[model samples]
Target: MLWVEKYRPKKLEDVVISKKLLDDILKWAREWDSHRKPLLLAGPPGTGKTSLALALASSLGWGTVELNASDQRSWPVISRIVGEGVFNETLSDEGEFLSSLEGKRKVIILDEVDNLHKKEDAGGEGALLKIIRKKPLQPMILIANDLFALSRDLRNHCKVVNFRRVDYRSIVKVLQRICKLEGIRAEKDALVLIAKNSAGDLRAAINDLQAAAEGKKKLTVEDVATTIRTQQTDIFKVIQKVFKSFDPEVYSMAMLLDETPDNIIWWVSENLPLEYEGDDLLKASLV
Candidate 1:
C-alpha cells in the first residue's frame, strides 16, 4: 500500500514523456474562454491520466472536483458540480480577514468516462453530449482508457489527446527514482527486466519492482528472475521448430507453439511471400 501511490507522479513534468501534450493542455488552460470545449484524455491504464488532471488543476490555481465513470455522471452531477451552481457559490473569509485567491474557473476531472456505457433508460450519454457541445462555466476534462469506445457525439465535441505507452528508458528513470526514495539498491539489469515485462506501463513496472523488492534492501537480476514474470516469446521458437521438422504431426506442432492464434496468423502472413511459393504458399495460407 505504501509503495502503490508513493511513486505516482504529481505533475506533468514528472510524467516522463508527455511534454508535447502537456504543453498543449497548458496552452488551452491559459487561453481559457467561456466556450472552451472539454478535453478528452485517452490512453491505457497506468499512464498518469489522473495524475495529469490533478497537476493541471494545481498549476492553474483552480479548485478541482473529481468523479469517476462509476459515479452518477448524468446531467445533474455535471450541473451541480461545474454548471450554474458552481458559479453561484461563494465562501466568507474567516475572522483573520485573509483574502481568498480562489479563481472562478474550476477544473472538473471525470475519470474512466468511457466506462459510462450508453444507457437507453437514463440518457447519461445524452447529457454528456449536450455538456460537451455547449460551453461550460468551468473547464472540464474527461479521462478514458479507450477513446474509440466513446459515443460519436461526445467524441466530436471534445478535444482529444492520446497518451501512449511509456518507453523503456522513461520507465527505467521512474523505477530508479522509486528505488532512491525507498532506499533500495536495484541493479540496472533488474530494473530493465521489470520495465520490459511491464510492456510500457510505468505503474505496472513500479508495482512489479516494489513487489520484487519486498523483504530485501537490495534487488538483483536473480530477484527479478524469481519474482517478476513476462509473457513468453516462445511462439516464434515453436513456429521455427514446426517449419524445420518433417514430422507428420506438423499441425499438432503448430498447435503446440507458444503463439496465440492471432500471433500465429500474423507470423504466417508476415513471411509467407518471402519463404513459400506455389502450393506451399497456398497451404500456408489455408493453415
Candidate 2:
C-alpha cells in the first residue's frame, strides 16, 4: 500500500495540524442540526482537506456521499446524486444509513470544488447554491485549494474555514512514527530533510520517505536529499523563497531542480500575493 493511504488519519485527533480547526469541525458536526450551513474548507493541495472531511464523518458515525471532478459533476448529475442522498434515508454506497433518526448523518463532500466553474460543471454551482439556500437535510462540506475561485453567491451560503500548510515538525513526527512501524531504520536528519523538502505537505513527505526507503533497510540524509533533488521542486516552496530572498540563488536553485524558466515564472506569478505583502508584492511582480 502507498504510505499515504496506509497512514491516512482515521480520527480528528490523528490529524497532525490545526487543532482549533479540528475542534471547530467537531463542534459543527455536533451542532449540525441547528446550524444547517455547509462548510467550505479552503487550503492548498495535500493539506488533509479531504482527509479531514472523511475523518470527521467517520467520527460522527455519518455516511458520506462524495462527488469529485472525476464524476459527472454537471447540474443534473449532482442534483440526482445529492438529492437522493439528502432526501432518502437509505444506506449510502458505504452501506451506512443516511438518517438523523438512526443516529446517522449523511455528509455530502464536493472535492476539488474550485473546479466547479468548468464548462462541464454548467449550472452545477447554481444548483448547489439552491440546495444550500434551501438547507438540505444532510450536512455538506466543500473542499478546495482556492477559495476565491468559488462564486460569491456560492461562497455566501457556506461557512468558510481556512486550512494552513502542515508544519514541518508535525510532519517529521509522523514520518518517524511511520518509519518505526515499517521497521525502516531512518535517521532523524533524513526524516527532517524529507519533511522540509515537502513544503508542509504531509502526503508529499510520506511519499518521499517511501521512495527513499525503497530497496533499503536504512535511510540517511543523503538518501532523502537525493530523492528530493531528483524530483521537481515544490512550486509552493519555490514561490516562498523567491518572495523572501532577493538573492540570485533563488533562480539558480530552480534551475538546479531542472524547473523550466517558464514554469518557475508562472508559479511565482500565481503565488506572489500569498507570500508577499504591500510594496514587497509589487516589487516582486515588477521583477
Candidate 3:
C-alpha cells in the first residue's frame, strides 16, 4: 500500500495543523445551527484540508457524508443533499447510535469546490449559492485548493478559512516518525532533503522516502539524491506557469518546483520583471 494512505491522520489532534485552526473548526461543529455558514477550508493541495475534515468528523463522533469533485459538481446531487438527508450511516465513532442524542448530526464535506468550472458544471455554482444563502441544515466543510477560484458570491456566503502550506520542519518531523515506525535507518539529512523537495507537501515527502528506502534497511543521501534527480522536472516550465497562469493555478504550479516553499518567493521575485511591467510589476512585487 502507498505510505500516504497507510499513515493518514485519523484524528483532528493527530493532524499536523495549528491548535487555533483546529479549535475554530471544532467550535463551528459544536455550535452548528441552521443560520451558521459552512466552513470553507481553502489552501494548496496536499495541505491536509480533506484529512482535517475527515478527522474533525471522527473526533466529534459524527458520521460523514463526503462529496467528491464529480458528485459535488452535479446539480441534482447538490440539490438533493441540501433538500433532504441522504446519509444512512448514523453510528458514532464509538459504534453507538448518535441520532437519538445529537439529532442525526453529521458533517457534510464538499471536496474540491474550487474546481467547479462553468459549462462543465453549469448549474452547480448556482445551486451551491442557493444552499449557502439559505439556512444551513447541517455542519458542512468545503475544501478548495484555490480560494480565489471560487465565485465571490460563494466566498461571501461561507466562512472562508485559509490554510498555509505545511512548513518543511513540521513535515520533517512527520517523516522522522514514519522512518522510525518503518524501522528504516535513514540519515536525517536525506530526510531533510526529501522534505525540501516536497515543497510543503507531506504526502509527497512520504512517497519520496518510501521510494528511496524501499527494500532497504539503511538509507543514505546518495540514494535519495539519485531518485530525486531522475524524477526532477524542468524548473523553467514551473516558472513559466507561475508567471503566466491564472491566479488559482499559480500556487499549484509553484508546488511543481523542486525548491522549498520559502525559496519559491525568491524565484518569483527574480522572474517578476520578465513577466509584468509598470503598475502590474509593482503590485505583484508587493504581493
Candidate 4:
C-alpha cells in the first residue's frame, strides 16, 4: 500500500487540523442528524480535506460512499449511487450480526466538487442542489479546492468550512515521524526543505520524501535536492526568485535547472504577490 494511505489518519483527533476546527467538525458530526445543511470543506490541495471527512466518518462508526472526479458523476449517476447510498443503510448481514448496528448512518463524500461543472456532469449541479435542499437521510460532505466554483444555490444549501494551508513545520514533524516508522535516517534540513518546497502540500512532501529515500536507509539534503531538481523545478522557488531578484540570471538559472520558460512565466505571474508589495506587485505584473 502507498505510504500516504498507510499513514492516513483514522480518527478526527488524529488529523492535523486546528483544535477549534477539529472540535467544530466533531460537533457538526454530532449534530448532523438534528441539522440538515451539508458540510462543505473548501481548501487548497493536500490540506487533509478528504482525510478529515473519511476520518470523521470512521470515528463515528459510519460507512462512507465517496465519489470523485474519476467517477461518472452525472445526474443519473449521482441520483442512483449517492441517492441510494444516502437513503439505504449499508450494513450487511454479517456486519449486523457482529455489532449492534441499529440506526447506523452512512457518510456521502463528494470529492473534487469543483469539477462537477464538466460537460459530462451537465444537470448534475441541479440534481445535487435538489438533493441538498431535500435533506437526505444521511449526512453529506462536499470537498472542493475552490468554493466559488460551486453554484450560488448549491453554496447556499451547505455550511462552508475553510481549511487553510498547513504550516511547513507541522509537515516536517509528520515527515520525521514517518521516517522513524520506516527506519530511514533522514536529515532534518532535508525534511525541512521537502516540507518547504511542498508549499503546504503534505501529500507532495510525503511523495517527494518517498522518492528521495527509496532504496536508501539514509536521506540527506543532497539526495532530496538532486531528486527535486531531476523531477521538477519548484515553481514557488522560481516565482520567489523572479519577484525578489528580478535578475536576468534567475531565468538562466531556471533554464539550467530544467524549467521551461513558459512555466516559469506562469508561476511568476500567478504568485507575484507572495514576494512583492503593492506597487512592487503592480510593477512585477507589468513585466
Query: What are the per-residue Cα lDDT tens digits for candidate 1 across 83-201?
Result: 44234332222211112354244577888788775863343666566555557656788998788888887888887889998888888988888899889999999999989877677
Q: Give all candidates' CA lDDT scores.
A: 0.70, 0.76, 0.75, 0.76
Candidate 3 lDDT tens digits, 232-258: 545556777777766676677667654
Give the alpha carbon lDDT tens digit for every residue of 157-220 in model 4. Answer: 8888899888999999999999999999999999999999877878778888888999999999
Q: Name model 4 segments beyond 4 Å from true.
A: 73-75, 85-103, 118-123, 233-287
TM-score of each predicted structure versus truth = 0.71, 0.76, 0.74, 0.76
lDDT for model 2, please.
0.76
What clash count goes with each model?
A: 0, 0, 0, 0
Model 2: number of clashes?
0
**lDDT string, candidate 2, 1-287, tens digits:** 89889999998788765668877877887887787788999987668888899888898887787778335435465576565555655455664444645555568888877766543234556656766786766788889888888898788888888988889999989999999999999999999998887777788788889989998889999988887766644656666777776777776678765334544676678777787789888887787
Better of 1 and 4 by lDDT: 4
Q: What RMSD, rounded to one decimal, does every model reach?
A: 9.4, 7.4, 6.6, 7.5
